[model samples]
Target chain A: MNLNNIYELRWKVLPPLAGVAMIGMAALALVTAPTEVIEGDVQRLLYVHLPSALASYFAFSVTAVCSILFLLKRDFKWDSAAQGAAVVGLIFTLLTLITGSLWGKPIWGVYWQWDPRITTTLILFLIFSAYLIARKSSSLDSDKSARFCSIYAIIGFLDIPLIHMSVRWWRTLHPQPIIAKLNPALPDEMLLVTLFSVLAVILVAAWFITLGVETELLSQRLLKLRAIAKINISEKS
Target chain B: MSEIGFLFAGFAVFWAGMFTYLVILQVKIRNLQSQIDLLENIIENHDEV
Candidate 1:
């Protein structure tokens, strides 16, 4: 197979490669640290929620990339990729909420808290959901839907950094960016493991989005082919 | 009584969820491939006539 086949490319190779690395990082975390004095086993929630959230951001960023490409190239494949990533990003957003809530029960003493980070995350989720809805309104012309979805996708990407900065801009209890490279607070081991986890999930996200886009395109191709076949058979009869 | 244990469980669930999704996608792609193949065979047979 030629390099043009995504299956033959390096980026496509990342899922399995990163999967192994993630498992290794998990092992490192498992061995190096003692149980937290307070959150106990629950403290592990940090690793899950943070990485999931980061992966969600990464997915939306890819959506923006695809959306721009679709508009510039006028290629349907890029638009399909944007749609695929948006759906996956939305799922990861929900995961972030669930695991965050699970962690909150132990640390914040409440199952739900209206923290800055939490609120922005919720908004981000809603925006993407709306993006999907806009993509499939059924009444719009195909060209119109593609245009609107592309526009909405660009809007969604612009919202991500605003979501991140909201916690600092407002006096919220979400603890002001726990992980920044310039001035770090968490122990190096913990931070490294968490970063590794983020990278792992991002690879998983890319693999998923690529597969999804190809599947959707294949379905469309199938539908068109079948319709043509039916027409030809009826003409013969 | 460790922060790390919760940490471990979180990672476990996340990885498991992603892996399951990947497996599901694999199955779906296989199914679609079969459908496409069958359709193509029908079209080819019809053309032969």
Candidate 2:
């Protein structure tokens, strides 16, 4: 097939492939991944929670990179990409918070805590949310809105590192990094499942961001057409 | 609630959140598609005149 056919085939295959991977990872995590010796079944939440955190990090990183590109190149395409990534990052960050809470209640005997890790993560969520709000409030001018959001995305990314380091840098109820460390404390089966879960989450995050970007691009196109139509009507009058 | 109850809740919340987001994406895409079509039609008619 030609290049266009190849591109079409890739897009057609990706969503289903990512969906299947997500299901398989979920099954492995919930059903087959080995239980923790200490935390028992409650530890199973790691399969979802940790991967969600990882996916959020990946999403935010994409936002940061795209935001930088938008700043340098001044292209709406990069702005759309940055906006999409920020949205995905926000959703996954919220998911991480919810799942972490659910996991915490049974283990820590509390649904919420003011631990450094938890606090920083909440801040991260709030930051990206503000980026979305800025995007909305500046809807009157697309270029100015994109530039503002790009700057917001870049500045907000500073929180990610602090969130990642909170447990290590301060006294906190949250546990230190396990899978992220050079020497992880996971067993073979658990480690395998964790890796699989991370992969699946990344794939799903990519799909979400791609969908967001496509929708944004289409909306932008429609907006341009409306503007043109308005100008035409004004000229005729 | 039992430990198992918490576990089930976690799974339920995760799955439900993902499903809801997926549905939202579809709805937004559909709305945008329709809007694009309408705008395109309006522009085409204006050009024809």
Candidate 3:
């Protein structure tokens, strides 16, 4: 099949599959997963918060890899993919912060904290936010803009490691990594639900990045077409 | 708010944010598609002329 047909097929197939998976994840989280003895229902926010955090990490990793590829290959497609991943990463990061805050309120007695992990996460968010804004507002040519953004993305990705280690590097209110260790902190049932939720969020993030790339490429095509049309008009005049 | 209230609000915010982002993305795609079509038409007509 041709490229357009493949793109069309993905567009048609991904959304419904993602929707159903997310619905199933919600059921598993809200219904099947046992509630915590101490925190009760409010602990359920972990289902969303943890998944968002994982998905954001995945998305930023994509951006970092794509940025490096763009720098190496000097291809606009890589730049487009990097931009798409960055957008998805930003969305997931925002969700992570908000959901984490909500989960914190009942457990920690305050929604906002300057704890090590939270602060590092906030810094990560700010870095990406600045990356997007700089990318959009820059007056540089396409190649220059892409190069600048690619380097910015690579630098911004340095925050990911810091965010991951913040809990261990300092005494923080934030809980340490639960599922990442040899022995997970969560019970089997809750761990299963959390895993499913992470899968669902990652699926959603992939779909979003696909849509974003398509839109960016279309915009690029439109710009090229407009430039050609302008040249034709000038010649005719 | 009560614990249940917090629980409900957390889920509600997550769903609402996801839905709103999807809608915004759809609109952006639609707008970009139309602009692409317009620009392609302009280029084609210019070529014909």
Candidate 4:
């Protein structure tokens, strides 16, 4: 197919497909899950909450990567991707904070704590928020702001691994891995649903990133055309 | 059952927020696209004149 068709696939079809997959995965999580002795009704919701945060973290990482590329290539595309990723990532991060707090309130007896996971996640959120705010303060030139954010993104992503691996290295009530470990915490049925949710969330995150990036590029183009049109009018006058 | 209601509430609120944001973006695209079209028309009319 032609390039436009490919663009359509990335921008149009992908997000819906991801959304369908996410819903399907959520359904599977609900259907297959046996009630946890510990968290009761809220336990099953882990499928959505954990995956949303993971996807958000993943999106932010993508932003960082694109930001680094922006610094190197000085290309607006990278900046666009980074910007879009930051916005979507922030949404997911906020979800993480909300859902994590909700889960924590019942499970941990506290809405929030200075735990490693929470602390690192908060750092990640601040990093992206700072990047976005930095964008606003910069000259409206997309590329320059991108270069600035890219540097921040690269620095910001360093905390992601720390956020992820902190629980393993230290003793935390946040619990250990159901996967990514020598021993899995979850039973196969629960694990199965979690896996499905991860996949679904990942695809959805990818689709979101693609759309956000494309939209940024389109906005830049539109802005340029407007500026040029204004210039032409001024010359005519 | 109360907990279940809250869970559902969370989902509803989250998804609604996401949908609203996307709708706003969609509106922006429409506005930009129309401007681009207008610009193109003006350029074309200028050529014909």
DockQ of each: 0.47, 0.78, 0.77, 0.45
lDDT of 2 by residue, A86-197 (tens): 8888888988999999888877778986666777778889889898888867772478778888888888897567666764466445464332222247888889999999
The numbered model that scores best in TM-score is 3
Off by over 4 Å in 4: A1-8, A159-184, B47-49
lDDT, residue B25, candidate 4:
68
| Predicted candidate 3 versus true structure: per-residue lDDT over A92-159, tens digit per residue | 88888898888788877789767666777788888888888887786323799889999999988976
**Using lDDT as the measure, which candidate wins?**
3
Score chain A of model 3 by TM-score against the reference chain A: 0.87
Q: What proportion of true contacts does candidate 2 retain?
A: 0.73
Model 4 lDDT at residue A69: 83
* Candidate 4 per-residue C-alpha lDDT over A1-237 given as tens digits, one digit per residue, 9 for 90 to 100: 899678677756787788899679867866767777656766766777878888987898788888788788887878888888888898888877777777666666667877667777887888789888998677546565667677878877876686667753664555643322212388788888888888887887787777677677777787777787777777667
Winner by TM-score between candidate 4 and candidate 1: 4
lDDT of 4 at A153: 81
DockQ of 4: 0.45
lDDT of 1 by residue, B1-49 (tens): 2444445555666767777777877887788788888888888888898
Ranking by lDDT: 3, 2, 4, 1
The candidate maximizing DockQ is: 2
- Superposed by TM-score, candidate 2 places the C-alpha of residue A28 at a distance from the truth, in angstroms, of 0.7
DockQ of 1: 0.47
User: What is chain B's TM-score across the candidates, in the order shown?
Assistant: 0.86, 0.94, 0.96, 0.76
Q: Which stretches of candidate 2 lie above 4 Å from their native place?
A: A1-10, A162-184
